[model samples]
Target: MSTTERPRILVVGGGYVGLYAARRILKKMRYGEATVTVVDPRSYMTYQPFLPEAAAGSISPRHVVVPLRRVLPKAEVLTGRVTTINQDRKVATIAPLVGEAYELPFDYLVIAMGAVSRTFPIPGLAENGIGMKGVEEAIGLRNHVLEQLDKADSTTDEDVRRKALTFVFVGGGFAGAETIGEVEDMARDAAKYYNNVKREDMRFLLVDVADKILPEVGPKLGAYGKEHLEGRGVEVYLKTGMDSCVDGHVVLNNGLEVDSNTIVWTAGVKPNPALSRFGLPLGPRGHVDTGTTLQVQGTDYIWAAGDNAQVPDLVGRKNGNENAWCPPNAQHALRQAKILGDNVVSGMRGFPQKEYSHANKGAVAGLGLHKGVAMIVMGKMKIKLKGRLAWYMHRAYHGMAMPTFNRKIRVFADWTLAMFLKREVVSLGAMENPREEFYEAAKPAPAPAAPAGAGDKPKAKAS
Candidate 1:
């Protein structure tokens, strides 16, 4: 209860790790024993796996994100970014959304700032490409794609229509593949209502520099996914890199060229570069170097997990590969967060710290409605499935993994509604610039009758 002397746990970033870790810590802590504070740029933690569905309108955008304040009611959630962490002084410099920066002292720190989009210095990428990292981006992409359909539908020029209907997605990982599939399905459905637009008229391209797609599910399933997409009229170009997309003129390494108005980039993600300012020892690839205990190397009070930490994979180590690290994905993130919470509590109470370890379960991905691919690992058995059955498996697994019961019900409701009603093809593109019409109307009325009489009087006053 002491204001200045209470043990303070500072959680940086309110994404997956930050949210679950804080929740776990609070649950394990005795009444008012320690103070937990979470800080992030956004107020909600986005469930990234459902982002594609949100973009495709299978689920509402709001349901895909969990509000940090509402879920972590017992913890203090601050909307800000941790600019720098001074480990020696046990203080972190926090730059809030508004106001001057201040230092917050903490007894323990959790660095879960997560990853940002890993981008190359490709020309025009910054100006022309869109990302799918957040709920906002998903909704924006949905609107943009629909808006493009509107453009193509209304245009008479063949060149303009061609450019408008061409959609290019760079990267063939889970994100890129799932996104293109969902959005393409939505577009195909939307074409039914448009007079000029048809599914065949639209060009959907998936380009990746890698030789294969969906590498997480192994070669066999990956090949099946590639074949399935190609069968759906998608042009899957492997080992193809983008040369430049300047002004939407896509030039590919395979000597292919296309004019497209929409370019979606889901190449990869890198740990948040902000880790450097924290003064923690980072790996060569920029992730905070973490041991099997999920604690930062050489530091007892600082812990890290999720996409930002280079956590050792104990399972892999036991298999005789010592240098293997946990891949940055939802499965590991969720598990590491719970273990991290327990470790933090144990370390505080002088209890022994438990090392983090887990074997790979498998991977699953949904490709639009009634279509998916899955790989389940059961000891020596590896179960691979596709089509409607795999689609159900994907939903069951992720639906259960989604953070809270509230979200589980909402997501299931969205799916239930979809079964009876047709997919919502309407796009609220105006949501992005909702105030445009209002701003035009609210413009100050023309100089109220600064008529000839007022002008003559002003000239007389000049003397």
Candidate 2:
């Protein structure tokens, strides 16, 4: 905690940016020159691309996350939430998991907190709708889907069964598309074990405000994706808005009403709201305004990247427009963090910092097992693929891109093992409420038998 020691670089959020940024800084900086400290609420950085498979039980949840502490051994990893930043003082207020809030002073700061799911004033969204933002959500969705099956199979009541069998997804982007696909695949596999619940009996709906889905992949691939989903009996409602999900009754803008117990919301993500609390420049969408060099425009010591930073896309140049910013995705986040990290070292060493420039590498999305759509961009050539080949390409790219070597091998192994074994469909729903059984048992029950008395035996026999 001495002010005369090595300069401190404090990184907030341990997602794609924070993890790699610290790693790059640790690699570039000379010993005893600076110290890198990463702060995040969770110790691990989840490979979000595998979340759908995790939800589908295609991969183990434990393997999907890379522990930050284990990877960045040279950097100090603090598990905490950063409450406020006093840019003038170059200090961050951190609320650690175990102790009272304290201020952490630093010479440089990197804001990489990432984005949160964008929800609106929908009546029951906060209370009922499920989000697909983290590993917990993926696991919750899996358990909730399987629990629906349990309800449908056990209950004789037609209304309850109908309510439980219907599943609704609010967005048709990659997250929504892959999630519904995986869950539907899981439900289909699960039906084989159930006596009453048939796959045909269940209804899956994907609703979006846009006329087309997966715009990142060109129109042709998006249309193909829609057709593939529809062929599997999933309904696509486009150019329509969701009015309310109040009382679990989904009222659509087009006058369609459905009573579904499971509603997954992946509409979109907005920049973390905490960025606004800081006295910094923000773009139209509330993202921290950053220059092409990935540094806060007016500041020298502070840098930002990932979903929270509005970084201009220099690679996708147009007719004299050089300020087009990069989109918030794993592809850009990964590249941006590397540059951002290098730029920090460059600043410290008085070397020239380079601007971020990367062209759009199109998009790929897996509809389900052995089914997907991919659009890869190269110079003037655009490659479009679908079906099993596209699925393999999707897996191959993401699997190789999985953050750490430890995770990359495990994910590849999961895919390898999947070739021989059927996907898991069992629901560990009790995980959601892990203490429910303990609380039930702890409830003040009838006084314990008085030394296993004769009176207790007589009462038990009479009952």
Candidate 3:
């Protein structure tokens, strides 16, 4: 039979789960047994755990993303989104980036669309906030923060300088804490080059509703992380929330106000909104409901795992926790995707599906240069490390976890060079609008005015 005639496996994302699942499925299935196809809006799969480093120039933005087509050569990669899925017909509606919507029929479906930033209806947040969900945002953030420094140095007005140098980050989770930490370090280095702007002139603030930050690393480490940031002159706001940020003026619930030019919203994320139309069972928080086998509830042919799916925490349940679910993170996503793929292949080939179960392997987080916190779990033994040692573990673990040997080498090389070379502080702000200069110079001159009624009705000529 031809390739098109083979059983079809449709993967609905190109993120960590989608990429690893598709790769695993391809390896497990026999030759010509099934054809794998992955669809996502982006052509590449971004290693989001490395996004902060990319934003801080510790790793090149390109290395943080893995091109789908290049890595999955045997699978069909579609640069489009699965707008809706109809299990009744086993078909999905595909909306390409620049084409009309089309229907794609498949025998198997993998729902791994991933998550989007969770935001509230706050005043001016939509207009002034930036997100760290994708690689583009990381690059944009790097440029934006450095550009703020340039603005602060050139301006003579006190208010402008204050606003430009004041960076406000909302949310104190991994993304929020790590990002503000990395960005603050970058700005500190950048200030050295600016004659007028010094590190003391800038203000860095982290706001979170939770009492402690880095809760994933446990409360003790969280407190340590908090103190570490505070030592670096970062104001850590606890048990508070952002009320408003109108016109770069931040108003906190505690009645504190600051005019900040940069507002990064990394509060949290919810499962992709697109999952609703997929006609699948969703949990309370909008994640696809799945069983231990990674198969969607009530469906054997459909599967989901990752930030988008609500998978049971089997280890937690066995340990006497009746209500436990896996948290959304790269650790589980990587492992879940592997098991999800195995289940898919098993379901297709008349084999028993494997149940997914794994204990939490702890967490590691890097906070700027040579500052970090880590918790290592080895069975019954739990080892905790902090400071420079934790920083090395952060790099070593993530450096090895990074997909593709090519990217791992590139990331390590970037770190090696940074050890001896001065930090990169130049701000390429125009990159955000690269076409502006070209448009001004090349846009068609305004049509010569109809000074002599050039566009008037030519009744005489017509007659």
Q: Order of all candidates by TM-score, from best down to worst?
A: 1, 3, 2
In model 2, the worst 10-residue window by lDDT is: 452-461
Clashes of each: 0, 3, 0
**Descending-lDDT candidate ranking:** 1, 3, 2
TM-score against native, each model:
0.96, 0.95, 0.96
lDDT score of residue 95 within candidate 3:
96
> Across residues 1-463, which tens digit of lDDT does each residue of candidate 1 receive?
1245778999999999999999999999999889999999999999999999999999988888999989999888889999988888999888988999988889999999999999999898999999999999999999999999999999899999999999999999999999999999999999999999999999999999999999999999999999999999999999999989999999999999999999999998999999888789999999999988999999999999999999999888989998989999999999999999999999999998899999999999999999999999998799999999989998999889899889999999999999999988887989999999999999988766665666554445565
lDDT of 1 at 25: 99
* Candidate 3 weakest ten by summed lDDT: 454-463
Can you tell me which runs of candidate 2 are displaced by over 4 Å?
1-4, 318-323, 446-463
Q: Point out the higher-scoring one by TM-score: 1 or 2.
A: 1
lDDT of each: 0.93, 0.90, 0.93
- Model 3 bad stretches (over 4 Å): 1-3, 444-463
